[model samples]
Target: MPPPSPPPPSLSPDLHRVLSLLPRLASPRHLLQAHAYLLPRGGHRHARVASALLLASLRLPLRDHAAALVRRVHPSVSLRAAARLRGRGGGGLAAQLHSLLVRAGHAADPHASASLVQAYCSCGSVASARRVFDETAASADVVSWNVMIDGYVKSGDLARAREMFDVMPGRNVVSWTMVIGAYAQMKQPEEAIEVFRRMQVEGIEPDGVALLSVLSACGDLGVVDLGEWVHRFVLRRGLCQEIPLMNAIIDMYVKCGSVKKALEVFEGMEQKSIVTWTTMIAGFALHGLGSEAVELFRRMEKENVSPNDITFLAVLSVCSHVGLTDLGRWYFKTMVSQYKIKPRVEHYGCMIDLLGRAGCLMEARGLVQDMPFKANAAIWGALLAAARTHGDTELGEQALLHLIELEPHNSGNYILLSNIYAEQERWDAVRELRISMRDRGLRNVPGASSIDVDGMVHEFTSRDGSHPSLHKIREVLCAINSNIKSVGHIALLPESLHDVEEG
Candidate 1:
């Protein structure tokens, strides 16, 4: 290739310094300073200066201004040259070039129109992009339609994206994937799966990207059968077990409550990324196989797979779930010493949870006090929960003090403190706390419980009468309560006594 052109002759030495940072601008702020310096000198007319600014601010909110600069400087710029620019990456560049072509009276040019649509979408101006698409509707190419759909998908305008998809005369693989991916991204996994089915009915086979998205939807919905079927299809299609596809498969199994299956995949993998190991470790932890998780970490070390912060988080969580206090502490030490992973707030919280559950309330409190980072509500909550378990009223009260200040509006904090008082038969104290809560218009967050009957889930909240069948529900519950009492079971439940005497 020919040597790149030199910086514009009209640019000064200081301005040239800023131009040199093109494609590597420090921040939006610096980009603005450069524009401020150049736009006044009319240097924006120079091809190099506009291209540089367009490149620097591609990810910034300066596209429109850059496009205007290009148009104002060269109203009759070359259409073919600008179209070629669109072939390169970046919506910002495409946008500026679109303006250049439009100024040259080529606004209706198919390539020009499509480039404008893509550029507006890239800059997050989805509405503006849609306007361009609509204006050229009769001549809009599939590329323009697909870009518009993808834009809406990325912008969280799922309804609009679906509308575009439904109206497309001809749908390509990209079109199908974008819409399906949008549903999954919006957490509407059920809708995503339905879209996948529709795509299959239309005889449009899914590529790797589409398949990965479908698997993600299955995982989110906890449909193991669908995930397994997809896995079999993947193998039959000879799809390479790339790192991302492998991770998604493992995640699907883990999320579907089949950690053993996830482990089987993990063990059989010839190549594993950090994400793969982390997924397996987290799966083991989730399934209460703490020892296996810890052992996996050891194996990871032997295999020279460096543990990132997430790995340590999973390992410590494994220890916490299984009450392996000494093991958790050892991993925390190993994290800092051997792995050089600095402890984040979550790591500290895990440690506190371990110490608190192990009846080391004092040590947990001391760690909270000595940690470099200020303890958050979760850390203090762990301490308080531990205190309640071990009947350390003093420490419990101490932790409660911090938790109350940290989460003043959280009704659980007040309710928990009241329970602590009730445990000691401090009825008067409990009543006082209830009164204070009532004064503050505070009510305990209702506990959620659910049951499945005839393959349909019914949910209810404690002390709530919102359900349509609540009256019937209460009757059934009371009968169950009577039966439990008949079985010699004594439930030590707290009484709900709130005096609503607001000050």
Candidate 2:
């Protein structure tokens, strides 16, 4: 249940007696009687009495009375009440308050204006919020602008948010943090890092939120040095006590390809949230340390920490990677039977993938049919990949059919099927498939990879010699390839079939 409203800001004993009576009133008729008594006593002019009356009217399901009463209440009280109402999904009531504010000649109150803007934003009426913001631009403060930027971000209009941020007269830590977090969430890590750098250059010491977003960007870019620096900063600032920051630190290490460091951080933590445990398990999954992941999960269970859906996902992924078929099956069943967690698409996808990788093609197909939901493209793609690996052309064709329907524009599905045909020396089938692809105007998308060097991200696309450091990069790759070959390294043939170099 919602918490009781904070006692309508400290009223006189007389006003308090009226406020007390407002909550006890049983119906709109009684509330209207109380309102009738208050107006003639000149109590309607007091902010507390006006607020109490408006709230009492609302509680009685008297929207018309509340809207009319809003016009008589103090502007600040109405806006404050509207902000609170926004949390309860009262967008319409908030709009009524806004209209009353304009009509009551209180639009010039800066604090009330900011609160109204925040209310509109929270209500998902961003366009309405923008209109209010424009009306008060001359009087708008940093808080007002920040609320609008936050509104645009919530509406998934990051471009507009960034545009507003660029033109802001001044920015605080919250402003910079919002943009940084937004960019990281949008998967634009480079932009996030760039803005972070700008924030630092301007002498803005980042708060915990800013640091968390920067660490996320650092992890995405695989910039371990920057992530480590953030970790040190967290330690220096005594922010490591915050579980969320610590969780982000571990995640950063995992994504930066530093599983050892991730484990070190995880082990050192005296307190761990479910997120902390899950992040460590996922870290082991990423590094293919399946045994370690299982051990850690057991430890978590022994400590009486309940595994969440994400925790199960992490463990199942570890099982998939290392071909622990029986273990995977047990975990999948236990997740549903014991934990009472309904399996989502990702869970089903992981199980199907685990089964496929273990050469249980028919059983995997059976699971797809038995699933509560229709098989998605990822499920079909996993089955097709496994079929190609095991030379089950019929199963591959079945997966291809569903994949084509689910994702008609995806050239990768067509290419996988063609590869399966080619592997079996069915040249006639391959030729027909190629003709179909050509007719459909489908071409294989280039594979891409990226690496971070000295804090800068460098991306490379298959067969693309566009980088300025192409010659040096080629020389380094050739040397590494030669060294690996000297140690008897052998490439996986089926995996190489789709490589641009092989084509």
Best by lDDT: 2
Q: How far is candidate 2 from the true structure (C-alpha RMSD, Å)?
A: 5.5
Q: Estimate each model's TM-score.
A: 0.71, 0.84
Q: What is the lDDT, from 0 to 100, of the residue 492 in candidate 1?
A: 26
- Pairs that collide in candidate 1 are none
**Residue pairs in collision within model 2:** none
Cα distance off (Å), candidate 1, residue 44: 11
1-503: candidate 1 lDDT, tens digit per residue: 11343454587776677667765776788888778887677665566666667555544656565555444543222322332343325545555555555654667867667767766676676777888889899988788899889878878899999998999988999999998888888888878888888998999988889888988987777777778877888878876467788788998899878887888888888889999999899888888898899899999999999999998889888898899999899989989998788899999999999899998877888898889999899998888788777777787778778887998888887777777888999999889989988987888776765543432345555555556775565566566667767889974222211111110
lDDT of 2 by residue, 72-142 (tens): 45565676565665543566756767776766667668887888888888888888889889989988999
Best by TM-score: 2
Model 1 accuracy (lDDT, Cα): 0.76
TM-score of model 2 vs. true structure: 0.84
Candidate 1 least-lDDT 10 residues: 494-503
